[model samples]
Target chain A: MNAIIQTNELTKTVKGKTIVKNVNLIVKKGEIYGLLGPNGAGKTTIMKMLTGLIIPTSGEIMLFGKKLAETSKEGLKRVGSIIEYPIFYDHLTAMENLRIHCEYLGFYDKRAMIQALDMVQLKGIGDKKVKDFSLGMKQRLGIARAAITKPELIVLDEPTNGLDPIGIKDMRDLIRTLNKEYGITFLLSSHILGEIEQVADRIGVIRNGQLADEVSLSDIRRQRTDYIELLTSNVQRSAFLLEHELQVSNLKIVKDNRIRIYDAGISAGQISKLLISQDIEIEEIQKHTSTLEDYFYHQIQGGDKVD
Target chain B: MIKLIELEWRKLDRKKVFGEVIIYWVILMFLPVFFLKVVFADNPAVHFGESYGAAIDLMLPIQMGFLLFGASLINHVFIEEYKNKTMALSFGYPLSRKRLVMVKVLFIALAVFFCSLISFVLAGITTYGLDQALEVIDGSPSAADLMTYVVRMIIHSFATALASLIPLFLFGIWKRAVIPTVVCAIFLMQFPNFLGLLRITLNPDLFYAILSFLGVASVYLSVKLVNRLGDL
Candidate 1:
C-alpha cells in the first residue's frame, strides 16, 4: 500500500517537558489505522501536530507525499481532523455547522451536506440546535463535518470517547462505511480496544510519548496464543512447584490464589500432579486466551513511550 | 479570502448572531432619538442648534463604546470556537492562518459597520422628522452638514471599533474571550476621565493629535500581532 502520511522524528515539547518525542509513523492509503493509548498518553498531541493545530518542535511530516510547511495548503486541503473533543457552536444546527465547513473547503456541494448528515444518521436533525444533541449525536455530527468535504484522510482523536454501546456500534459501522465505500483513509485514536479492534486494519500502540508497536490486527491475532489459567489454593506454592518440578518457566501469578501458565504444552493433569506434590490443592484450572486488552497492558509495561 | 469570509458569515448567521446585530442596530438608533425628543420636545430652538452635529458628537462616545464592545465580540467569536474545539476544524481547512484571521476581522468589521450605519440612518430620520414638526430648518437642513456629520460619526464609530479590535485580538490570543471584553469595558468607562487628565496636563490640541495617532497605530499593531500569533 502507498503511504498516505509519514512522520520522521516527530517531536513536540511544551515548556520544558516533551509531549511527543522522536516518533515516526506510517499510515497507508485507504486503511483504517488506530492509535491506541490511554488518556494523556500523547495521542491527542500527535493528532494536533498532524493536523497542524500545533507546530511540532522538531521533525518532518509528509502528507500525501508533500512536506507540511507554512504554505502546505494543498496537503491540508485533502485532510480533515478532530483533535480531541469535537466542538461546534452549540447554538447552531448540525447542518449549519457542516455548511460552514464546506464553505471553508471551497466545496459548494449542496448535496454533500445532506448526504453527510444522512450518513451519520443525523438527517432528521437539520434545524435542532447542537446544544440539545446527545453526546453520541454530537460525535456523529463531528464525523459528518469531517466527511462533508470528502477529505482523502480523516484524523479522529478518541472519536468514541463518550459513546454508549449502541453509539459505538453505529460509529464503528460508519467508520467502516467511510473506509470501505468512499475509500477514505483514517487515523483514529481511542482507548477502547474493542472498538478499535473492530474496524482498524492496523493498530499503532502509543505508550508514554512514543509509538510502542505498529502491528496489523490480523498478525496480532495470528501470533497471539492461548494460555492455561491454573487456580490453586496457594498460587505462590503452586507456581514455585510448577516451575521447579514440571519445568514450566512461563508462569504468570495473577492474584493471591491464581496462577496462569502460558505454556500450552503442559497438561492440566501434569499441573495438578505438580501442585499436589507441593501440597497445593487446585481449586480450578482452565484455558484463557490472550485478548487485545492484555496485549495493550503488556505493551504499556514494556516501556513504550511514543512521545 | 472571500470564500473564507463567506464561511464565517454563514457560521455567524446560522447562530443568530445576525439577529443580534439587528437588535444592536435598533437599540443604537432608537435610544438616542427617543431620549432627545422626549427631553427637549417643549423647547426646540435652543436644543435644536445643529442638533444633528450634537447628535453626531453624542455618537462619538457611544460609538467608541460600541467599538470597544465590537472588539470584545470578535474575541468571543474565536473564544467560542476554541471552547467548542471547532477552532481545530477551522485551522484544519486549506486556508492559511493569516487568511483565517483576516476573514474573521473583516467579518466583525462589516457587522459593526452595518449595525452602525443602520443606527446612524435611524437617528438621522428621527432628527429630520423632529425638525419638520418644528419647522426648524424652514426645510430640510443643508444636506452637506447632515452628510458631514454622518460621515464623521461613521468614521469615529469605525475607528473606535477598529481600535477595540487590537486589545480584543491581543486578549483573545493571550487570555480568553471575556478578558478583552471586560478590559475594554473598563477602559471605555475610564477613557473620558483619562482624556480630561491629558488635556489638563498637556496641550489639548497635541493630546488629541496623539490620541488619533495612537488609534491608527493600535490598529496596525493589532493586525501585526494577530499575524504573528498565527494559529492557536
Candidate 2:
C-alpha cells in the first residue's frame, strides 16, 4: 500500500507541558485509518500539525510522498479536514456556506455545491439559516464541506460526535463509500470505538500523546481471544480459590462480583462445581469475546505503567 | 488573488453584508443633507460652509468607527476559521496567505471608498440646493468658491478615510476587534483636544504638520504590521 501520510518523531508542547511526544504514524492511501484515544490525548493537536494549522515542535510530516512543507499549497490541496466542532456563519444558509468553501478552493463547478449537499442529505434546506440547524445536521454539513471538493485525503476529528445512531450509520456509510468508490484515504480520530471498528481498515492507538500500537482490523480480530466470565456474589473468594486451589493464574477479577478466566484449559463445568463446593453461589457464567473497546482500554491501561 | 477576492465577495454578498453596507451609505449621505437643510437655513453662507464642514467632520468619527467595524469583519478572514477549526479547510486551498489577505483588504478598501463617494455626492446636492436658495434670497456665491469648498471637503474626507486604514489594519492583525475599537474610540474622541492644547503652548502650524505626518506614518506602520501577521 502506498503511504499517504507519514510522521516521524512528531511532537508538540503547550505552556511548558508536552501535549504530543515523539509520535510516529503512517496512513496508507485508500484506507480508513482510525486514531483512537481518550479526550485530550492530543488527537486534535496531531491533526492540527498535519494540516499546518499549528506548527510542530519537532520532527516532520510527509504527505503524498513529499515533505509537507516543501509545497504546502500542493500538499494541502489534496487534504480536507474538520479538526473540531463544525462552525459556520450562523446567519448564512448551508448552501451559501458551502459555496464560500468552494470559492476558497477556487473550485468553480456550479453543481458541486448541490452535489455536496446531496451527499450529506441536506439538499432540501435551501435558504434556511445554519443557526437553525441541529447539532447532527451541522456535523453532517461539516462532513459535506470536507468531501465537497472530492479531496484525495480527508481528516475527520470526532466526526460522529453529537450524531444520532442513524446519523452515525449514515456517516459511516458515506465514509465507506468515499473510500471504496473514489479511492480516497481517510484519517479519522474518534473515541467511539464501535464506529471506528466498523469503518477503519486499520487502527493506531494513542495514549498520553504516544502511539501505543498500530494493527490491522483483520490482525486484531485474529489475535483477539475469548475468555470465560464468571459472575458470583463472592468474587474475591472465587478468585482466591481458583488461583490458589485450582492453580489457575489466568483468572482476573473484572468487577466487585465478576471474575474472568482466560485459561482455555479450565472448564466452566469444573469451575462451577468447584465454586459450589466452596460455598460460592455462581449467578452467571458465559463466554465473552474481546472487542475494539476492550482492546482500547487494555492497551491504554497497560501502556500507562511503562510511561 | 482574484480568486480569493471573488470567494470573499461571494460569502459577504450572500450574508447580506453588501445590502447592509448600501443601507449604511444611504444613511450617511441623506442624514447630513436633511440636517443641514433644517438646522442651517437662516445663515446660508455659514449654512453651506458648516454643511460642508459637517460632511467632512462626520467622516472623521464614522471613518474611525468604520475602521473598527471593518477590522472586526476582516479579522474573521482568519479568526473565524480558526474558531471553527476550519483553518485547515482554507489553508488547504491553492491560494497563499499573502494573496488571501491582499484580496480581503482590497474588497474592504473598495467598500469604504464607495461609502465615502456616496456621502460626497449627497453633500454636493445639499450644497447645490443651498446655493440656489441663497441666490434667490441674497447675492449668489461665485462658482469658483463653491468648487473650491467642494474640492477641499472631498480631499479632507478622503484623507480621513485613508488615515483610518491604520486602525483598521491594526485591529485586523491583532485579531481582537474590541481592543482596537475601544482604543481608537478613545484616541479619536480625545486626541484632537489634546493636540489643540499642545498647539496653544507650541507653534500651532508645526504641531498640525507633525500630527499629519504621524497620521501618515501610522498608516505605513499598519501595513508593516499586516505583513508581519502572516507569520502568526
Per TM-score, the best of the predicted structures is 1
Model 2: reference contacts kept, as a fraction: 0.50
Off by over 4 Å in 2: A229-284, A302-307, B13-89, B134-158, B182-186, B189-194, B197-232
Candidate 2 lDDT, B1-232, residue by residue in tens: 5666666666543445656556655665545445445654565554334443444443333333333334444545544544554444555455554455556556655555556556565655654565466532234445664675566545544543444444544554455365664466356535655766787454533433444455456545544554344322
Clashing pairs in 1: A20-A307, A21-A307, A87-B84, A209-A305, A209-A306, A209-A307, A210-A305, A210-A306, A210-A307, A211-A306
Query: In DockQ terms, which candidate is top?
Result: 1
Candidate 2 local lDDT, residue B184: 69
Instruction: Give the best candidate by lDDT.
Output: 1
Residue B212, candidate 2: C-alpha displacement in angstroms: 8.9
State the DockQ, from 0 to 1, for candidate 2: 0.37
Each model's interface RMSD (Å)?
Answer: 2.3, 3.7
First chain TM-score in every candidate? 0.83, 0.82
TM-scores of the candidates are 0.81, 0.78
Candidate 2 achieves a global lDDT of 0.70
Question: In order, how many clashes per candidate?
Answer: 10, 0
